[model samples]
Target: MTVDNIYDVVIVGSGAAGLTAAITAKKNGLSVVVLEKAPVFGGTTAFSGGVAWIPGNPHFQDRPDAEGGTRVDRAAVHDYMRHEAGNKYDAAFVDAYLDYGPKMLRFMERETEVEFTPSLYPDYHPEAPGGAQIGRSVTAAAYDGRRLGKEFKRLRQPLKTITFMGMMFNSSNNDLKHFFNFTRSPVSAAYVAKRLAVHIAHLARYGRGVQLTSGNALAARLAKSALDLGIEIVTEAPVAELLHQDGRVGGVVASIDGQRREIRAARGVVLAAGGFARDLARIKALYPHVREGGEHFTPVPEGNTGDGIALGERAGGHLSQGLPNSAAWMPVSKVPFPGGAIAFPHLVDRYKPGFIMVNPAGRRFVNESHSYHDVGAAMIETCRGLGRTEAWLIADHRTIRKYGIGFVKPYPMPLGPHIRNGYLRRGKTIQDLARQIGVDPETLAKEVETYNDSARRGEDRQFGRGSSAFNRYLGDANHKPNPNVAPVENGPFYALHIVMGDLGTFPGLVTDTQARVLDGDGTPIPGLYAAGNDAASIMGGAYPGAGITIGPAMTFGYVAGLSLAGRIADHRAGQAAE
Candidate 1:
């Protein structure tokens, strides 16, 4: 398709946010074009779990005959999330998001074929002062990407191999028992056998199946909507600069196949390109500790290099500070050699009772089983105290043999690297392992003795770790006294070095509630807007729940789309009246 004139709106980045904005603009009767730098459509959104945290959504309302008497009111959800975020979340932004998120979700559900279901996953801060047990996250229903035909290849898939319509392992004793029973039950066994047969038959009949799970489903839905709306998506089209006319964004200069081309936006231009997670130099400059010693692992594609922020900065956009706090850092097992190089988050639940994590000083820091966000914060603090950012995961041979520790059997997949490489350090005793890892053997031995004494007493007085329900939820079920608080007694200890890493940088071009790109003076740049990671996160420094990024990205994209269309309509009306 050839275009001679400017469209109503031009969107940069075809990820969840960008595509959502383009489709919203089209629905508002505005001409729109989406430019993506990658050969695909969905950016990080395609690689995520696709869970949107929308408190007080209609989907959470009690259904007739539902087992639980749990009722999630608007006020309750708002208060709960606010409290969960330590009341530091932007109140107005959260309010606006909660108010419009349901409507926006319904619009996608009705207008497009994007089916979704409320996830049974508990909130990350479930045991927080006012957190709820469930009904905060939503996931897209499986979609047949074949519906998009050729457009299917342009969509990104999840980085992890998540199970589709299978029971989620909650990393708790009760949950594990339930899982085992479900697999062993006669009816469940028969159902699984039938499902396997059906899958085999589908594979035989067609080269691919239509069951979209996790992030893939979400990406497929968004891609389908863009295609259905006739929104032109130019892949490998990276925006080089924002064209300005009289101090206002009027068009964009983009590089397509190494050729520079100019495209004008009659109404406005929206920037949704993701953050710079893979930019090693920028990361090191911003986070010195992480660069020097912290572990950095990201499953994001190599193309994510801060192109959106660069283009906007070139056009005089203002960036926000505190970028160091925006990343998702956690301990990860390194990938092994011979074609296996993927790093998986060292989930504490998977560690069982035989292991524990400690700092370079040979002392237990935060609860080793905490969420990555919490662990990341702890890592940062540990680094600050030690004048360096480095930690180690200590475990025993029993833990390795039982849970497969780092060397997950699926060779060439996410955890295969640990098995292939010597990253998994092993020793016959804790002291020997500590010496091998360059840590003080006496300090590590003392720390372990103190921890084992606490475990023997079935209490964690120092950290109060095993006290929380969430903590015990991820503990080993077989432990008699307590699942979470266990002694690392068995010998043949191992240690793996860990560094802090993040999914992407958070802080970027500042935008308002409407997602209009603002200047250094805190004023909106005319005909210019930003969304997704390219803009300052609306949640500030706190992560409220899953899908926090994608939720606001879609919400603000809708807002920007409407805002652009309204501007074009007003302009035409003014001209016609004159």
Candidate 2:
């Protein structure tokens, strides 16, 4: 019956979407507070690649060069979305996203600590209608965690599997290139040495690296902006239920610092609490692999357990269903660490030369260099009747040492640890490797031989590995005719078992163009809005390009803030005239 505090807006979640909404609302003359269930504030965004796929981003449009300088056409972007989403495409939502996504980016960069650099990442399906080979994706610029002062400690750390000694690398290939060429190139050696020295100093001073990159940098920048605007970001606050009365959502009852308190929102409540990817029961019902008795692991924060969706449902919102896919699928392998194991999404290694993915039967099913989503979908469908949605990544000693596989790093980093931990399997010959991995020797040998035949000729007769622009983008350009094709003929082959995983869920609470949560009858639940993974993906279960999820999440979050602010402004204007 007693209320603890109140604000014009209350945002559930502190990821890119929630912080974006808070920043926008505050800038638009509304008092806002962000509540995060996790002790940390970044949600899954901090652990992500920090890239956003904005079709007409101002950064790319301002410059035209051979890399990604082509002007983005709105019509073309729309056509591409239509082709990617197929029947699930919602024109109203798509229009809103396309119209506001760029504006959102501009606003954040101009008004906050946000900054972006155009990326060379291509559309997942660059050959699709209206798809561009480049100029659509942009990643957050690297930021210094020192800017956040004390709040930097609360920022979620980057995925450990991808970092070295808690030191994160930029998503740009340039940073990795320097490390990869450190031994061969003198210039790179000095660069790596300097980077390592700086990282060591940062570790000593901050107990973690202060040079933030990727999603961590994005999260830090956003948090700094929110704090600078005098917004309250309350962590360890989990919403228990929505305060619904008079046919509208007004506030929330949340456990804050061990006390259940009522916090009313005079204007609206925005839900951006990641997604339901970790909600086992709900995923088992929605995810086909889980329903069919397969394991699913996610690298996102465990705090994202469909809290936003559940809260929306309690406030008369319904989840969107019947999408082709329920989540953004990715192939992940378990990397044995100190305690147990961690989910490591195979984002980089597969595209390198001399790597191939084979099912349990030792047959190649898909082009290993394809997008992670495509490869994951293929893996799921290939293993549908096999009871487990899984596959194995095979590589020769040369390739394994040159590029590494899964969480195992390149040469100079001993493979003994991985081999001892049973995370990696090795064999001196093809037949020997097959036996170690539980595959029939003859079948495995024949598959390798068949693949080598085409690989030697710089072609994939069966699966067209390096045929697409997107595939080649991730491939080693220094390699021969086919960057993604090479013989796996070297002895001492290595194999890692990979299974189905996801970046985030796609099926979420149904919402309108304004990001308003919708009821079963397609009516907006007043004062309740959804953004980020809490809102059904505008891409409609399809991963169109890099940063597809983050891009739209931010756009809709901006929309939700604008919607609430606009409505209040209109009401006040009418009253003032009276």
* Total clashing pairs for each candidate: 6, 0
Lowest lDDT sum, 10 consecutive residues, model 1, at: 569-578
- How close to the true structure is residue 455 of candidate 1, measured as C-alpha lDDT? 74
After superposition, which runs of candidate 2 have C-alpha atoms over 4 Å from their true positions?
1-4, 62-71, 567-578
lDDT of 1 by residue, 312-348 (tens): 7777787777543666554555554456655555644
Best model number under TM-score: 2
Question: Can you write out model 2's per-residue Cα lDDT over 217-247, one digit (the tens) per residue?
Answer: 9999999999999998899999998886576
Q: Name the TM-score of candidate 2.
A: 0.96
Q: Give all TM-scores, in the order shown.
A: 0.82, 0.96
